[model samples]
Target: MFQPLAELPPPALGEREWLLECHCARPVTDLLKAQGWDVVADLDCNVHCSSPDRRVYVGLLPESQEAARGELWHIHVTDNSGTRTWRQTFGADTPAQAIAGFLAALIAFPARYCTCA
Candidate 1:
């Protein structure tokens, strides 16, 4: 007979966990997935959402660089027509905050910035 090991709890808010470390990024990705969008959470912690038409791609970079200035996020919308719009310095107080902001944006105006249009 063997005993079970002690359980471990998740990290605290201030911990430097990756944006997509667990299911933290699921809310946004799940929504997009339900809408027939292809969502990819890359190894670098960035997420990409694309439409079935392959016309538009929405990329969310929570923290591209480790050593930099402020805690910034880069969000961009690109299309095959060469039309692109981006925000290179969307500041966030923390990774959770960044995920919240990005989720809010996607929920509020997905068509405006995403292929959901």
Candidate 2:
């Protein structure tokens, strides 16, 4: 059987300034917000979602001219009070995949973060 956390509302259009070649910020933030998370999009195009002492951040790294020459997405989670942090990067071709990876990471390490109010 399958169960959802909540009956989330549909995401609003043009609500946040999404990056041009984004692979992980916009949709992830929208999902987070729908799940009752406090999310913010920053000037650097990073989406930050937090709950109490736990924080999750998603950022996009476009194809560059340097050595790391590919499009990448980074997701990080930090538990301020627990003094722990987890970060992972993925060579994702889409924003939804990157967000799914990040969510999977969080699910794999739930004790490392705070989920309270």
lDDT leader: 1
After superposing candidate 2, which stretches have Cα over 4 Å from the reference? 1-24, 61-71, 80-82, 92-95, 101-109, 112-117
With a 3 Å backbone cut-off (N, CA, C), the pairs that clash in candidate 2 are 23-95
TM-score of each: 0.44, 0.46
Q: Write the per-residue lDDT of candidate 2 for residues 1-117, one digit (tens) a residue.
A: 555658654458767545334554566666566556677656754445664345665555444332164436566666656543777665555556456545655655757336783
Tell me the tens digit of each residue's lDDT in model 1 across 1-117: 554455555558788565543325565566667778798888877777776665445555665662145534444555557677443444445454455455556556645444655
Best by TM-score: 2
What CA RMSD would candidate 1 show?
Answer: 10.4
Per-model C-alpha lDDT, please?
A: 0.57, 0.56
Candidate 2's displacement at residue 39, Å, is 2.1
- What is the TM-score (0 to 1) of candidate 1? 0.44
In candidate 2 the C-alpha lDDT for residue 43 amounts to 73
